[model samples]
Target: MKKARILMVVLFLLGICALLKCTTNTQPPAADGDEKTSRERGEFPDFGAMIPVAQFLKQYPGHKIFKLSQDYPKQLPGEDKIPAFFKMPFDDKSKWMDWLLAARDYCFEGMIDADFVAQDNKKRDWYHMPWLHYGPLASEGFSGLAKEAPISPYQLAPEQKHPGQVYALGFYNDFAGHTLYKMWNTSTDPDPFVTQGPKGGFPEGTVIFKFLYTELDSLDVPYLKNPYTRLAYITPTFKDSTNRIIKTMNLIQMDIMVKDKRADKYGTGWIFGNFCYNGNLNKGKTMKDRVANLVPVGIQFGNDPGYKTNWINPYPVVKTMINDTLKETFINASADLPPQHLGWGGRLDGPVDLNTASCMSCHATGEFPQIAALVPAQAFIGDTLANGSMKYLTQTDAPAWKKYYYNFKCGTAYDPKKATSTDFSLQVSLALEYYWQWKNTLMGGYYSHQYAGIQHMAIRGGIPFKQVKMIKKRGKKQKVDSLTQTQDGF
Candidate 1:
């Protein structure tokens, strides 16, 4: 009996040991809900994604302008809906034709009607022009007019000092300012500047514009009438010695979008500074007469047919064009200067280098206008009652402009002047603007970070429609519209 009891004890101990081994050897489940072994599972999330048009429409109905533009007669008509002139077969009505002729006027009607600025402050009739700020400084008699002369690459003198400073002038504005933004470069390596604070963001500044007019000519729209002779001025915040900051100018374009699949990168629209080839009006080119002569140079981003974009020479981002000679010179010239020492608002590098235009002056980290890198600025050009008046107003009025001007603040409600730094401002600005215009409330703010940071998010392709047919096509099936749900007669 004693030997049998001992044998039972030994058997129980062995069984317990076996159970422990089984529990310890088991492995946790794979991430991404994969059941496959570690070797068979994919390594990372797929970044190469093409957002479908249907999905984009379903996700963002208001952004799907084509549906509204195409079927305007059938849809509800109001201030919120598509304007009749923009409708398909737009010339179908005479009253709408006159309205369509002033489409840009309609787009800006609220601003004119609001008169957010001076009633007499209208120095020039800039509102009537098709494209604003799209010409050279002195192309035509120092006005924003495009010079009859041909445009060539800028011949900048060598920098003799450390961190040179030059102000690009010609473009002007009133109480409110502009905010240009850029997407973080996802291709080469992560931008070291991106972070949680003001200092932690994409570098941005003024980049001079020096492109051949022949290039601009190639970008002409086929059926559309070209507005300006040439694109000459860029907007910047620089002041004269008297302590004025707005008088400063640069020859740079706002809202440049870059898209590259192979680079594993895409660019959000970015704005920068540059030199105007034309001299100032009185001292060089007078501010009033300078931009007034400006005309439509070319369209950078197209809203039709798959959303194609054309920049100078087909090069997307100017940062990518810096060659060895330019890089070598910039590195040597900027060696002694401390990074982020330029302060929150400092913008300028000494004389421009002929070999390369230093785009980083305004674009690299820590520039005040790097507002877009940290937050979206233009998004607010229409957010408030006054700003929205400037944005959507048709008939200009000064009293209205002032009433809405004070409400314009780049920062948050806590502090509109300056609150949270970095991408948050742009995000918040975009949120406030889109929410007010499209959604009309904070609860319904329709801004999306994904689309906000990626300029090409709205570009897409779809099936072609039949010319003579009366049927609405969905996938491979064609059905008569009257027979669809609305005709079900409940």
Candidate 2:
């Protein structure tokens, strides 16, 4: 009888654990070091994670889940900053390659220094932006990558047949973490620094790097093979997919951006650059050597507002078109760099990015509430004829389309009335979108529900038929429709 009682208790406990994700989470999130008193004083409410991990674990027990790196440094301790490797302007012949190489090395070295489990350790300390694991469009599975864009059948190469999804994951250095800690210090509540805070935005030398992986393999792109691959347990394309599966994704692009205004005479104030993994350079004997195979795509600091080409390079790019006249863009034509369908007449975009948008063109619109669509309406809005010669955006010179190409200074919100600017951090804007949506789901709030982008979340691919008014500086107005999810990482 006693044995039966013991067995029943053991079975009940097992059932409870089996029904949920077994975790050592405690209330109020920050589980150590006088955090309760700090919370009482409104210091750091480290509200751990919002994914409702238990439910996700129950749903997808066989797959892996991400750990929230929310043990954010509440107080930035030192005055040291990442040294400016560029030293001179990015265009200076002496330091140009150094600038691009530094960005590449920064990304690669950081990835190397990260603990094997990624940002899950505080001692080895690289961090992920919290609250990105929310809706169907939020973040998917073990990779914790969000769907950024779709690749058409022949987008990357001629042999390509299957349409695929682009999944991206970005990491912030400790300096950027300082800014994140400040903005989320209030924990469950919106910090004043979020959209309109005096101390909002990253400090001068924050370096963020992202790795973009594609569901397409060597068969699709030909250049992707061997070590440049990853297995993603994500819910494929549109989150509307019922079952999630392990997709073999390949490393296609790595984007690195820095917050510095020194060389940005155009005043947009961020240095953006990316590299394309050239698998043809597969000469290494080890994994690191094979994976280090990258070709510098380009560096972009500002939108050449003066130069308007109104040109879009269609895919299956055979020859690289390097625009020699743009004042703010630079493309390396080395034999090492593969043929790229550059952004908006060769302004600095990577593989997996919409060929119609530049690095800055897509990132400059990072703000809450997403008053402006991430990309111009012409990129997808009105259909184009299949004649192969017509301009996709025939009205590319219109004020609305031109707005995306204009240089907006750092931290200037795209729409001041509805949201605050993240300078050029698209990850922050996307995180806010996911955070608010999850917040509203937990318990709806007046501000959370209204600003959670309820209408924009309903949108999936490109712009919908309906229109929303995009208000610009000088009270200018233009019709805007979201490309997808209110905002997404570029």
Off by over 4 Å in 1: 1-81, 88-103, 110-292, 299-490
The window of 10 residues in a row where model 1 has the poorest summed lDDT is 456-465
Q: lDDT (CA) for every model shown?
A: 0.22, 0.65
> Which run of 10 residues does model 2 get worst, by summed lDDT?
468-477
Could you give me the TM-score of model 1 versus the true structure? Answer: 0.20
lDDT of 1 by residue, 237-266 (tens): 111111211121233221111111111111
Best by lDDT: 2
Off by over 4 Å in 2: 1-65, 84-88, 113-117, 120-124, 192-199, 381-391, 445-461, 464-490
How many pairs of residues in model 1 come into backbone collision?
70
Clashes of each: 70, 0
For every model shown, what is its TM-score relative to the native structure? 0.20, 0.78
- Residue 19 of model 1 has an lDDT of 83
